[model samples]
Target chain A: MGNRSKDLLQVEHSHPSSSRESSLLVGKNDSKPLQQKSYLQGNPITVPFPKSEVLGKVKDFIGVISEANRNLRLYAKDKPEEYDIEVLTGNESEYIKMDLMLGIADLHTPESLAAAEAAIAGCQSVINRNSTSSSLEFEGSSEEEEDEEEDDGGEDDDTRQSGSHVRHKDSELQQDDFLSALLRSHQKKKPSKIIELSVQSGSDCSIRSMAMATLRREGKRLSPLISPRPIEALRSALVPYQEEAHGLRYISTQAVRNRMKSVKSIQKITKAMKMVAASKLRQVQSKAENSRGIWQPFTALLGDIPSVDVKKTVLVTISSDKGLCGGINSTSVKISRAIHKLNSGPDKEAKYVILGEKAKVQLVRDSKKHIELSITELQKNPLNYTQVSVLADDILKNVQFDALRIVFNKFNSVVSFVPTMATILSPEIVEREAEAGGKLGALDSYEIEGGETKSEILQNLAEFQFSCVLFNAVLENACSEQGARMSAMDSSSRNAGEMLDRLTLTYNRTRQASITTELIEIISGASALEG
Target chain B: MSSSAAVPFWRAAGMTYITYSNICASLVRNCLKEPYKSEAIAREKVHYSISKWSDGKSEKPTIRSDVAED
Candidate 1:
């Protein structure tokens, strides 16, 4: 194997392109001519002849020589430009000299072959020695020390087996000594001091042997048999243990501690928010209560009039702009959608004038077809009469409706709110009702100036009533938003507190387990030393 | 408790009442068939402001040429 690989390496170094060509020419019948052509170019040999073939053919001496001589003479005479006789003779002489130097004649003899084999073996041994020393130098000294220790332990085991032979002989000798001592003691039974001294020495030797055995056992226990390499062991000792389940690794103690800290801070923030919302709710609730009284007379005036003939209805959905108010905005949106659904028909078309972005975002998704106008940022500050009036003006100018239904979350309690709807008659509706003279009987009771027409009074009353109802709805929705936010923040703070407790318990348990493991290791080490 | 503070309180209340009466009067005037109803509504439309477009151009021209262009 070595010789073949070496020959291939030499071929590769000498004729890399020829080696590729030869590999391509392999197993083809035309390979012989290709090989000869490549050999004629610069290579000295095309194919190496086997020793057996060369030796076997050598016996056909004169016939083969005369045939080769005649062919060479003919070739030289016919093509003197291709072959030179003097150069051929010089190459022949060099070849004969090389063959003689290599002992080609004595190659068939056993003694010369043995000598050649011994020379080759010596060279191979030298190469092997050099390769092993180079490899050992590449591997560092720490590995060498480990190997040496392993060798020493193996040798010790072997010596222990051999030492058993010597131990057997020593035991026989000790037995003989014991028999002699017994006989001597029996002969001199009054020598108690010497016997006591011998017994004490025996006990001391037994105790020392027991201590040595325990020390060896502890050493073996400390250095486990399939131990990791030193660097790997150090890394494993430093890294914290991680438990993986269902492809999810458990968070480390420090990560859990950080989460707990963030949750604690969040809990504090939510608690403060809850307090602020509670204080703001009181002021908003009172304003909402007063606004209801302010709009009561107008509502009473409109309530007496029956609704006009069915036409387009405008839905005014009121919700706060801000979120984290527990589902107050969603409840208003849902109630508006329910109203829109209930009032939908072939003759009656529902249009929406959404207030606040929360309801707009939701309504625009599914009810964009019904939405006529969306007003936002009105809830940034407390709702005021002027803002609502501007909004009502915008609605009145842009949209036409028979009835305007205001959908809003009504403030019920600090922890609860309900979505409510209130309807205001449009100017046309009030005109139609006044013309009917059915519900306008109540209006006739009020004395008016001779210049003031009843229709003008009703129109102004309708517009004013529209703005008043919208203003009341806005205030009520604002109060409800604060109350809902207070309750939401209260619950969020409670949940955060619970999560913090859980995380703290987990952190404490992990720390306690680590401490206990360290204590166990120390105690075991102390007991091992004592043993 | 003091007459000066009471004066300001009455002034604020009177101001509120005046604003309210003005809004009601304007609403009543804007109603159809009242004085200057069409012109008042046209003026309201011209002055109406939209959040999206602020050029203050009315949707339609109020004035037109009586003579036909050649």
Candidate 2:
């Protein structure tokens, strides 16, 4: 290939351009002979752009320019004058240049860049949250240790049970067991959960706020349960325990209080996350609803597509780029793994289309060979049907796939997001979807005109399928993300609040003990004087 | 391009000139007039005349509280 042709090809392959045809048209001017001395006078082979920085800053602008120029030369080979050189300035330009070099070097997937961006965004968003939600403390216990302790207690309670008076006794025992289990679990989980809650609250105040609201509700629920415990025995045991351990209880209580403050902060963050997710989910749901209207009629026109002899399959896996929301990415990853396991043969290799950066990373790590095409920045403009169509077209034309499968987290509601898989290319899937039935009332109302050809209908159907798959996947993934984030924040806030409560109690008790000891010394002194 | 960038500044200056008198008048009234006004001038003179050498209220309280507690 000519220098210009090579540059054009590189640009088409590497950069996120609006279109490739425009570059191709420009690349035809490659006959502008390499007569002019090179862009830089230095030998082409000498000192390939400096990677090191002097005093934490690039010492050579020439090196940076040369590196950019080299790639641009390759990219601009076909279309030398087409690229806007101004766009190659500042931080954005530097990063773009770096990415181009990385892409050429073939170090990582395109999703890796997106993942790094999402992570930075996530970190910034968290920091912003911490600053705002400073006041509210929703304290709770941690999940891991609490889970084990509760599981054991639940097992013990379940084994002993039935008969009126015995039932009453059993009920009493169970409630006590439950409370004791909760308290014990809280003691174990409180420290770590408190810290996590505080840090998250600091990072994301909205979640902390939500957690506070949950804690208030929990506190109200806990109030009724508090009285049934044998207070006298517990108090006596606690008091001696407090004294015997060289003020360890006092310190523990202080730790708990501080943790509680952290939890309250965290609750605010979680609550905010939930609200944000809820709004985003609603938007996604509407998009999905609209997409259904578009796709159902399109599919209906096709009548039926035979699913027999499914040879090669293309699977589009959708997940969120950033993970604070629990199990959203994991669930999608699981579904992908399941699909990989099901479609494992040399002839029937599964071509993977990863929608989100996080899912792409996971799938790439798991099945290195299967990821044919990966896309990121779905979260930036999730409802862009044009992008989806482009992606779908690339899959449909470039590769031979007998069928298409889409896996994503489905948004049932604010709290319930389930991992769902749909076979898009198969008639069986459509038939099942039609038979199993869904919320397609809006779609049924749209009327089509007479004598529309099958080809047009198929074209429309293909477009609709792409749009629907993209829309539904985005909605489900987003819903799952928000829900998971809310819960995580909620737990953190609760954990913090619990720590504060324990701390305040200890502080009070310490004060009381000091007062009592002082009184005793005064009384003893008085008695000796009297003697 | 240079001429185009400077055009807005000249327009802004003309607008600022039109509002200058009113702005100056408001500044004098708002900033200077208030301080000269007197409130209970006789009481202020009495406090100035009979100023006793005593600790500030905050300082007195701290002293009293500490002594009482002791």
Per-model TM against the reference: 0.51, 0.39
Pairs of residues at least 3 apart in sequence or in different chains that clash in candidate 1:
none
lDDT tens digits, residues A151-261, model 1?
Answer: 533443343334322222222223222222322222221112212122223222233223222322222333343233332332343333321231233334878878998
User: Where is model 1 more than 4 Å wrong at Cα?
Assistant: A1-252, A304-309, A434-441, A444-446, B1-70
Quote the lDDT for B11 in model 2.
37
| Candidate number achieving the greatest DockQ relative to the actual structure | 1
Instruction: Please give the C-alpha DockQ score of model 2.
Output: 0.00
In the order shown, the candidates' DockQ scores are: 0.03, 0.00
Question: Candidate 2, residues A1-531: lDDT per residue as tens digits?
Answer: 144234434543453432322321222222112111121222234333332122122123223433554565477677755544434444453211111111111101222222322332332121222223222111111244335544644443343221111222222333223223322333332323211232111212233223322332333334344433232333444455545765643334455456656666676776677677667656666766566555555456433242323667777788877767777787888987888667767566776777666886676555756666655655554444433444454445445565677788876665677787766554343333445445322333446454443333333354456555665566557766766776666666566567657766777886787777778889999999999
